[model samples]
Target chain A: MTVLDIQNLTVQFGGLKAVNGLNLQVQQGELRCLLGPNGAGKSTTLDLICGKTRATSGRILFDGADITNLAEYRRARHGIGRKFQVPSVFKELTVIENIEIARSRRPGLLAALTTFRTPLRGRVKEVLDRVALTDHIDSKAGNLSHGQTQWLEIAMLLAQDSKLILMDEPTAGMTIQETLKTAEIFNSLRGEHTIIVVEHDMQFVRQVAQRVTVMNQGSVLAEGTIAEIEADARVKAVYLGH
Target chain B: MNRTNHYDFLGYVAFAIIILLGVPFLLGFDGFELNTFARYLALAMVAMALALSWGTAGLLNLGQAATFGIGSYVMAMHLKLAASTGNPGGMPDFMGWTNVEALPWFWQPFQSLSVTLLAGLLLPAAVAGLMAIFMFRGRITGVFVAIITLAFMVALQLVFIEEQRFTGGQNGLTGLAPLELPGWTVDTYSLPFYYLVAGCLIVALLVGMLVVRSKVGLVLRAIREDAARLRYLGYDVAAYETFVFCLSAAIAGWAGMLYTLVLEFASPTYMSVSFSLAIVIWCAVGGRESLVWASVGAILVNLAEGRLSDMFVEGWLLILGLLFIFFVIFLPRGLYGLAVAAMDRLRRSPRTEPPVPVKEG
Candidate 1:
């Protein structure tokens, strides 16, 4: 039940190897947290898996399919969804319209032209309810608060029905209460969806991560349960600033 | 539909009434006045067309006049052929003057009115589709698209002017015969021709409105906002961009054809950079966000230009330039945004309370 398998993944930017010889595997319905200091190539690895960055040499097998050379949209079609550091949503469109786009079965131009707006009743309502954004469904996405905008992006991923969700710093720039709520939402999604989160806040990571993978200088330094990684001397010296 | 869309639909209806009924009633049947208005209406279609890509898809196509000129030349070629049926060698006067013995192979198909009409629409779309595929597939966006499109327009204009024998060069295709239908002829300076232009404008506007209200339009707006975000959401951003670009190009071409009919000629001037830029200005002044408002902007600007030029003569161009600057500085969203703000104020004045949230289970 491996949902994602990366083997010897490497991406070099000119003289720098941003992500080199990275290998990782995630099981279905597993909530894995990726931990690293700045410039540890955590984001680069995610980009490679999601087809945003082409690997210099490696294979990314998602759901048993080798998708190393697939386009970004093709990777997304294969159920890979990514949430960036900044909240990204259509600012001018209503919340309902944004969800409708993500929930669209056929995102082609011809299909979109013929698809009616009124028929998006069930799944749209369900995802909105899950994100607790049902009340603000008619408001413009730009008008949403920062925390709300982040939740709306999560709601969009839910509406997209993505099998594997890749989130980078989901709790960044949030108050304590909002972070706790986001942690709660992640916990709720753990058993039904496979998620890989790259987070800086250790407390947020402890709340949601079933297992931790620590990366440094372009490769995985260690992988273990949270308690095990905290006691590792190498992790302490490189990442925890001991 | 939501409240905003409902308001938008009402706006379209009011616009239709103004163009179809109000203007005709005001102008009466004076051929000169009607012809001028008809030309303005046709030009409005190009403005709306530009708004589709520039406003919705975030593609600023500065070479829109290339497609427009293609459409004009196609229609003019047909009319030129139709008018030369009795001339020596049965070819256009320009061709005969240029010492061409027979009609060129490319111009032969234009002899058939059906072919000419279809070509007028399809040629522009196809050309635009090709350019869009090239640019969008390469992930080119924003100002780069504008520069490339502007360059192509200048190149196309040069081709038309330099190829004197084929495209009628600087003089363009003139002395076009009246369009002949089953039992009637379309005289350019007549009521029927004016109605023809108006009817075409209405249909074009309806088509533009339909595009803006569909899910495709929703995605396009998203593309405009953040194309990279849409791409990561399992949508081919380039495909959507290309679709809208081609649609806009086809509409611009249609406008060009109507313009040729209104003015009785197709010239290299139609493909000039200034003409394409003027279309963009009209769209910007009308509020590029709303198609109807963009058309209104074109008509209003043209009307002002016509009147002011007559009154001030030497200084009218300066006045127009200053007015454009004022609109760009004060009303960045154009008149539509202004109207929307005004309406929002009026709606909130009486209620004084925030709207109640409709809870759903």
Candidate 2:
């Protein structure tokens, strides 16, 4: 059950290729780690898959449907979730409100006006409890701490019920304790949702990642477990530099 | 941040409604002379429209005046054309002044009030729909949107001026016929017109409240604070902007139609930047986020202008300008926001606003 399928996908920006001829597949309920050095198209691949940027060429299939022409929001409806490099949350909205907003999939103008929103509250509370943010549920999303915002974004993704999650540097700016807390949360969510994480921190990647893919120059350089990639001579020479 | 309110927000709204409803009798001794409050009431529709789009949704729409002008001029042209039928040669005074031969195809519909009313509603929406598609789709936000819409106002005014053959140029349209009700020929300046404007204002405010309390409103607030987050949340941020933009424009148009009947004139001045700024000032003075505050700001500011100009015509602009500047600088929340915050601070515990509480979640 391939949840996300990318074949020969490339992204270019006027004489610069950000992603090039990349082939990747993510299965349902798998925690896949995508590792790369700076400018290796890790985030760009996620961006392309999520329809943030157009693939210069190649196809993207999500849950057996070709979504190459879909807009970013349309892709969102198709069960693709993205957590940014920055912990982006609706600052003015409350915690419960933030998750509740992620719950509704109501379409059309009139339905949005007329639809009842009571059922979304239970799901919101459940996600908040999973993320351990129940106490801060009534607080504004903007006032949350840094690590908490990241977890809150994840909680929103959970509430959205997306089968595939794309995380870009979710632990970029966090303390060791916060990173471990995040890893615990990530590990707890492993079986129900398939996630593709683009991360720089190798220790965090090794904690919950089932398999890892190393990317450089917008395509996969290697694929293996964290231990396998860490011991690989090529990865050390090219990425870690001896 | 959620703050506890010492007094009831709904209770205050009810009190305000009581006062507003009682105004006819309160000022009955004066025989509704000029029916000044009715004019404010019509313009309050415009303010409420602005508050919904700008205050709650966080859209900076500088071109509200363009929409307002569209509605006003459309209604004015219709009224002028209707009254000019008896003067012979079949040419409006401004059209004749501009050396026109016949009424333009668009203006011909004014002959029937029914058609004019329809166009009065549709024309502004049509323009806003087209413009919003181009601008919001391009992800134009904040001050750029402001500049572009202000440009729209200036450009629209210029078009209205240059097309003097059609739009009456600078002198504008006048001498409108009284509105023909079911059985009464209601004078445009009479209490009937006042009540009409008041009714429209109330409708606009209620409609705005509906928008603010809808799922669309939730996403709009999200777009205002974090557009990218909303994008990832599977929301069409551009569509939200366009929807709100068109809504604001249409409401402004409705207000404009009423204004033409009340004031009995429409001029290029309706599209002026100063007029636009004055509306913004009204919103800023009353409080941008609260519907009641924005409308109150319009009435109070205009009423003050009436009295202040009578007392000191030379320095009123300075005073008004200073007042707006002072509020935006010191009390960014506007008067209502300040009052709410002040009252909240006075009380340590927050008010429970009913379970489910409209549940816009």
Candidate 3:
């Protein structure tokens, strides 16, 4: 059951092919890792999949539906959630309020106006508990520590019930302990949610990635299990300065 | 739900009591003073409206006066028509002076009080809705929104000034007949009219509070914090922005109508860029984050302006400018934020309690 299928996807930014003829497929419930150096087009590919950056030419089939031209919000509504490399939670709102917004079924103006906030309390609590942020539910997101902010963003994804989650550098600025905890959280989400993580940290990648996809200039250099990817001659050349 | 929010609620109740009861009775103000206060209250609505979009929805509408002017003109047109009932072809005096033979079709509907009332609010809302759709849909934000709105306001004021036969040009619609209700003819300086303005302010505050407390308000604040993030979270950021913009404009228009009643005319000056910026300054001074304080900012600023101008005469404008700069730099959150900080300090000084330990069980 392929949750995401990118076929010959290419995004050319003024003659520079940021993503050129990229093809990748992730099975439902698979925790896939995208490993690449800077400017390897890992982020660009995620942007294309989430409808943030329109592809120059390609077909993105998500859950077997062609969604290459959908709007970003519409794609999000269809269960494609993205966690930015930088924590981007609403800073002024409480953690609970942020989760409440993510969990909203109808995100329209009238629906928000008429709907009561009390009904989503149970679900919000559960999502917060999953991220180990239940104690800081009432704290403003701006007040959260860096690791806590990242976890809060993950909690938002959980509250959104996103079927396919795309995370970029999920453990970028975290202690080793926090990184391990995040990896454990990712492992716990396996089989219930399909996640694609773009990571630079090999240790974090080794802890969570079931399959590793190494990207070079603009396309996949290699794809296999962690053990196999580490042994690939081409991947070595790309990472070790060819 | 939090201590700060609890205190804010109580503060609003106290403010409401001051406006509804204290001003009218305990202040011992005469009819003239009361009418002046009524005018201040009317202007306060527009300030609060600006706070809703600028502070909550992250839309800096620098052309709020455009909507406010539309509201004032709509009410004034009806009053003009009412006053021209016995004139030739039932044409307003400005039209008569400009050599127009008959009333314009646009001015005809304003003959009915109910139609005029509805148009006062709905007209600004419709105009704002159109502008909001154009701007928000294009993903225009930040200072760009302010610039576009400011340009539109300048254009509107010019239109009012150029179209003399229709909008009375620079003079605007004047010598309006007092509003006639079912059995009573309301006088602007009378107690009933003052109460009418006060009552409208009260209603607007209540409605604003309801919105601030709702999930919509929460989402609006979220939009303000990061609209792109909200978009990726599956919300139509444009729709929410447009909703708040139109709503804020409608409230500004309502205030404009009340303003016409208090001042006895609708002038093109009401749509000026300076007037629009003054509304923003009022919101900033009162604290844009708090609705009650934003309104209070308008009243306080106007009251100070009245007194300072009388006392300083030549230097009042400079003093006001200095005051605004001081608030912008020293107290970014305005008086409301300062008061909240003071309250926090007061609470802390009484007891040096240890921080509560996080419960693991």
Evaluated on chain B only, candidate 2 has a TM-score of 0.91
Quote each prediction's TM-score: 0.96, 0.92, 0.96
| Candidate 3 chain A lowest-lDDT run of ten | A114-123
Candidates 1 onward: DockQ, in order = 0.54, 0.44, 0.54
Per-residue alpha-carbon lDDT of candidate 2 for residues B124-212, written as tens digits (9 for 90 to 100): 88888888888888988889888988998899999988877787777777777666656877676566666777777777777776676
Q: Model 3, range B1-361, lDDT digits (tens) per residue?
A: 3566687689888988888788878547578888899999999999999998888887899999999999999999988999999999999988988898889999999999999889988999999999999999999999999999999999999999999999999888899999998898988877788888888888887787778778888888888888888888888989888888988999999999999989989999999988998998899899999888999999999999988899899997788788889999999999999998888688888788753323321
Model 2, A166: alpha-carbon shift in Å? 0.4
TM-score of chain B of 1: 0.96
Return the lDDT, model 1, position B149. 92
Better of 1 and 2 by lDDT: 1
Instruction: Give lDDT for model 2.
Output: 0.79
lDDT of each: 0.89, 0.79, 0.88
Q: Worst ten-residue run, lDDT, model 2 chain B?
A: B352-361
